[model samples]
Target: MTTPDVFMPRLPWDAVDPYPFYAARRREGDVVWDATAQAWLVLGHKVARNVLAAPHWISDPRANQAATAGRFFTADTVAANMLFTDGPTHDRLRHAVRDVFGHSFISQLTEGVESLCKQAISTIDVDEPFDVMSQIAWPLHVAVIAAWLGLDPAQCQVLREHSPAVIRLLSGITDTDTLHVGLAATTALITEFLPAAADRRAHPRDDLLSYLATAPELSLDEVVTTAILVAVAGHETTANLLGAALIRLITPTAEGTRLADHIDPADATVLTELLRLDSPVQAAARTATADQQLAGVHIRSGESVLVCIAAANRDPHVYPAPHQFLPGRPGPSPLTFGHGAHYCLGSALARLETSTALRHILERRPVLTATPAWRDTPAIRGPHHVPARFTA
Candidate 1:
């Protein structure tokens, strides 16, 4: 296949309904080149999975000069982020906290997460329109992670206030003022907030901060950076997933009602299906370490590729009636949490939190009271406000 055969569609960075844009691009061909993004867009399920699982496709942006530009961070800081690293460095960083997100550890969090969900649900007034994202999902997620990290109320507050700034930094926004604020927020977290949390511990406690800060294998800088990653990634994706799940649950369609009533919160398959239908994290970026042929097209070394997880999840070849919300639909797992070595560490926790939260909310027999206003973060898709009311 030649370059001319590849479709180049305008990326819908600000589209309120962007799935159609993904569908439009996918219709042309799965492996299209986007001139605007200057990256190969992998919109098919098989191709996206193959790219994610391939060892030659690296996560490090430094390998590609174009991938490194427009970000405000120093090269060292970018390299320090495990999400952007590969090989032994990635393994060491991931292994440090791997067990923390395993089934045994996540199982222990179930009861506490359930209690937190119930407390959040109890605060909602019946028959009154309330933003579920703010009132329920966000608070519940923040509380869970804060407790997991053993952060005091003040430290948790600081995290809450500065998280958006950290998000801006991660989003690769090039606006001068925004980048300054983001840099300032990141610096404060590294130099002040995290250090304070570490200092509060006289000896290492059985918490995330203690583990990261006192680990023999990790340096102080590594501890601080990893902690920040934990704090930001810990709640954001799961909160967004919960918000999206709630929207689907509260839809007035007959299938929606059936799913709300019948879906088993503990059933991983059902939850997996939900994740496939409405993935929170949309796209993931990677750079080629060497020349490769992906889905029949040749990709040069140092070239970037954007794996469209949302599009892959809804690929008709993978899932029959791809757009419908079918809880028991059987197929290969979705790419919402990604694939291979870089699979999300907090996936188990996210699942436990989402399911536990949904179990409680479904008990109230909630319904949508108003249309949701979605956030414009194309990489991370979720509603900013989800107004809902409970019948029971």
Candidate 2:
């Protein structure tokens, strides 16, 4: 079969609602070669799951012989963490921190998470269009992750300033200035974490840094990189998800209001549906280690595959009325937190934080005063600012 000639939509990355774009691609085929993305776009739910679960598809961009969408820095230590590793290396890195983010550990934090949510929510002005992204979402997640990492106030402030720049590297950006800034921020973060990691080694504490410092499997450098990964991803994903969820619920739509008013945060499925509707991390990039045929399309060894998580979540075959936000919708789990070995390590914490925050916000009866201004970062999607007021 001839490769489909469709291209990725040219809309600004931040402002563009990618659901429509995904829907369009799915119509062509489950898997199509996108000349613009310079990779095979996996648009179907099953195809994405298969690709994600398959051990042969690697995360290390350095393994790609065929061109991929993003730039990978060999010297960038961020690439050394579990997010970019594969095989035994991936397993080892993930296993080291698995227990800390396990369901049991996360369950213990429910009350604490709710308390943090309430603390942040209590300070929001109820009478005006306050920026929820800044006032609540960002600060709340940052504080939670920072506390877990045992960071001081100064370190926490540095993370707030530099984490986003470090995240920009994930988008496969080509801008020279942006790349320089991101790399420099990455270095700064490493430097900042070094002291904490060292302190933990000398005088171990109950925090994540101390745990990492003591993990026999990890070296000093490994601990620092792994800490950086957890610290950055710990807040970024949840903050983005929380901001998006709030926007959807507070947008004054009938469905939004119905769910916000009636949905129970205690029901895991409700938050699952919300995640399906607005996936913060839209796509997962993988490189085929060997030749394979996927969804009837031949994938060459070393070719890049862009598993479009946002598209797969809304796959018409998987979810009925794919675009509609229907909680308790009976279908397979969304690939929002990913699948298989590479699944998000902090999935439980993220769910807890989002649900807790939403429960608190809904209690306040938030109203969106204006449309959210979306972030411009690549791959990651969330509002940079959500203008809103609380009515309760």
Worst 10 residues of 2 by lDDT: 6-15
lDDT of each: 0.78, 0.81
TM-score of model 1 (CA atoms): 0.91
Query: Which digits, one per residue and each the tens of the lDDT, describe model 2 over residues 86-167?
Result: 8888888888899989999989988878888889999876676688989999999999998788899999998999999877
- Global lDDT for candidate 1? 0.78
The stretch of ten residues in a row with the least summed lDDT in candidate 1 is: 1-10
lDDT of 1 by residue, 1-392 (tens): 12465432233455356688888888778898876666788999999999988888887655544442234456677656888778898888888888888999889888888788889999877787778888888888999999888888977777777876676545342245555776787887776545654674457787888877766666667777888888888888888889888787667775444457666767777788889988877788888888989888899988888898999999999889999878778788999999999899989998999988888888888888788888876767788999888888
Best by TM-score: 2
lDDT of 2: 0.81
Q: Give the TM-score comparing model 2 with the true structure, all chains together.
A: 0.92
Clashes of 1: 0
List ranges where model 2 is wrong by over 4 Å.
1-15, 65-72, 75-79, 254-258
lDDT of 2 at 30: 99
